[model samples]
Target: MPLSVVDLYRDVLPRTNCKDCGFPTCLAFASMVVSEKLPLKNCPHIDPETAARCQKELDAQHAAGKWTRRDMAEDALQWAREKAASMALTDLPERIGGRLHGDGPDRELHLPYFSEFIRIGAGGIRKENGEPLNRWEQVFVYNHMAQGGRTNPTGNWKAFQEIPNTVSKVKSMRAHVEAPLAERFGGKAETLGRAAMRLGGRDLTNESRAADAVWRFTPLPRVPVMLLFWDRADEFDAKVTLLFDETVTDHLDIESILFLSERLTQLLCEDGTG
Candidate 1:
């Protein structure tokens, strides 16, 4: 038989008045534990033995309820359909005029240039020469692209121009677009890097410059994804790179990506996929 919350508490929670889990009482923590909202590790009072036992129990529950990659893919496809219906687009377009032409490609069609960098503890953003960026600085350099709400100044300005637009849209409607998905599941949106679309009337195969924009997403916490986007010098072809955090890569199978992609694509397309 499985251990009930009562059994776990009676055998585990130290009945003391220790306000460790931010709860006024151990019983309150117990409630949270039963709901699986608070892990036993938060108690601070549990010894290693008890913590291990609780962890084992929770792990079992997670293994049983966890979703697979196929499940995510199905959910993502459904989400995409709904998004397409709302966006008034029967099928996603390739490009619109000089800009990207897709309705909600970011949700499903992985863009070419996306990447991730883990910032553990405090660190300064610096230029290539090791000069630290100012405290008021709005942009940080990552993979030859500038991130945050600032304009690029170098000759590479075209590489990061579209970021502001995407950030603005995401920020304006994050709750309406992202909250519901997160509530139903668990993940976060993050800005990983930037990219550029080919610009000018010249044939892309001969163009040297491209239009650029930032990349962002809601990812599972601690399970980061790497994205890479680049076009050939002629701008005729594009490429995408996806790097999964080794720690959680096994958890991020194709299905989860599909599900997340669908949800995001739907939200971005129709104005509300939350």
Candidate 2:
């Protein structure tokens, strides 16, 4: 069967936009691989065996037949939209910790995300500043779709593996989210604070006082993420620990968690701190 861009990517790609692979993003690199524009050896992170396996799969598929998986992104978004449109907006606050706005036909669900509120309407969504949120709407939609029971951020922080059923993702999550974050801003320790502030993160160190620098960010309601940064030392290299509320999966799927983590890394690196 023909492999999709994401399928081939999931096997060998780190899914981080580290740029060592020459393409700007691993996604783009995967595309280039699919198009025969770049070889797997260009990416250093992929082990020799994984690259060889991917190459064999590519060759076999190319010589025989190709298959495509169902378009998960579009289908999931449509399903989420339908689900949100059918539900009563009045129950949003209790279910997912978002307040309802307006009344009757004008009613919409308002959920806090960083410094902005993602407004969900029947048609789609908009940013707090009233800009069309084509990309962000999917997250809000998925948040609503996966949202079940409500839970608090427990103040206690844990790694992805510490969460249930997420142990398999520890290596990829560290490669894609944790290690890249440390590599990006671990040197410019001072500027990361401003970048975190841009994402509505506040220094929560005074409350817990465990990390050298601790910041709390709520990318979505009920999805509180804690980022702990430790500067490099003579004995220890720089480090970053990204923690999540245990109840995170209650509001977003594992894919969304990865997406949000990658997004945070992108935001941190955007200030050219790397």
Candidate 3:
């Protein structure tokens, strides 16, 4: 049978977001393995025998042109593109929280993505500078457009686990999104706050909670995310919790939501890495 990214992620990988494989999550690493041909051994957690077997399977599939490269992401991207293409361009702004511009085949929806604006149109998604988005970015924005959700964000927030149909993804949320932030900005609440603000996040520490720091971000116009960080106090370890507006699912599926959080974490950690 052909090797697929999902197979590698669900069956072979540890699904722990250990970062031992130099990727943010097991899912991202799995995509790299199946799509970009990253070595399976890059993941130190895999046993020698299992790694060898999986490599053999992957190599055989590659030779036979049977490897399913980025199966889920590519499929979602295609579906989003077709869906967006089918929708009336003029109606996208009201539905997705963007502004419509131009006319006819050149029409585009300009939407806020984090601190930047992206133009989505017949040419697909691109940054304000006109650089094209990567596959994951495209998948996220395209999926948002395809959803055509018109509900406004309710100011109320909910944890990822509290969201409907999210049980299977809770571990992923911790491993990939919340855990990484806790690990990176654990005792550094001020640093974390600054990093977040650089990306247009607002400090909301005074509103509620005994957290060391609290911030909110509007990565997508309709999806507002709240991040709470508990600094490493005496006799306690640091913690990070992400809360989302109740209306998040109306605009994005669980997978895309996770990706959005992961992207925020990536941006927050960039300054430290430099």
Candidate 4:
């Protein structure tokens, strides 16, 4: 006889429900499990041993090209995590503040700055419009820069100018945010670049080169947009040109740059103030 939902729940579920599986009860999940509509792995509290057993069984069903409840659960969890990670920081008060401040006046804006080189056509041609250049490029780039802080003379504007050392700061921020999030998503830092490339419909082939390509992506949910900057050095003159990925304009309105600047200023203040 085939296993009933009750039997599956008794044997497979942690019996805690806990909503960790995103279902109301273990019985509900069990029903889905028996129907091959959900995966037992979705139950976060289930012991690893039991999960392994359930997975093994599910894998066998899958090997025969049959859909199992386990696959559905896995797919649901993946969708949830992806949605969470893609959530815009603008929705979080800690990240973007509660209210939108109008673009009124004076403030300091900090942007991302980095150095790198752009290799064209793989020939290593170093001349652009008849000028000698180096492989290193320097750029002052910002993901989001808008009006921030008071109009006081001692505001972020003054500090912003002094903080060209944004590279170390950005690196620190990326280190703090990327690792744990990547682990949760079953991915690594490289996954972000791959996703960006896919979204941009461009191929990034030369990532292993000596030049450390600094890419910054900031998503503003309030404005419903994404901002990206690619900094690299010219092979001939060695000048750095901050290139805005054209794809960004397609997704985000350029007018949002004002708010972006403000949000970035807030970020700088928080990072420095602490």
Which one is best on TM-score? 3
Q: Which candidate number has the best lDDT?
A: 3
**lDDT of the candidates, in the order given:** 0.36, 0.74, 0.85, 0.36
Report lDDT (Cα) of residue 256, candidate 3.
81
In model 4, where do residues sit more than 4 Å from their true spots? 1-4, 62-274
Model 3, residue pairs in steric clash: none
Model 3 error, position 149 (Å)? 1.7
Model 4: which ten-residue window has the lowest total lDDT? 135-144
Residue 9's lDDT within candidate 2 is: 73
RMSD per model, one decimal: 19.7, 10.5, 9.0, 19.7
Number of clashes in every candidate structure?
18, 3, 0, 29
For residue 72, model 3's alpha carbon misses the true position, in angstroms, by: 4.3
Query: For residues 1-274, could you state the per-residue lDDT of candidate 4 as single tens digits?
Result: 2345776788667787687777798898876765654676777777888777777766566556454334543353344334334433343233322332223332111111111111111122123232322211110011121222111121111111123334444443334333222222232224434443433223223542322333333322222212222322354221111223323332222322323333333332233310
**Per-residue lDDT of 32 in model 4:** 70
**Total colliding residue pairs, candidate 3:** 0
Candidate 2, residue 210: CA error in Å? Answer: 2.2
For candidate 2, give the lDDT of residue 126: 74
The TM-score values for the models, in the order shown, are 0.28, 0.68, 0.74, 0.22
Residue 261, candidate 2: Cα error in Å is 1.9
**TM value for model 1:** 0.28
Q: What TM value does model 4 have?
A: 0.22
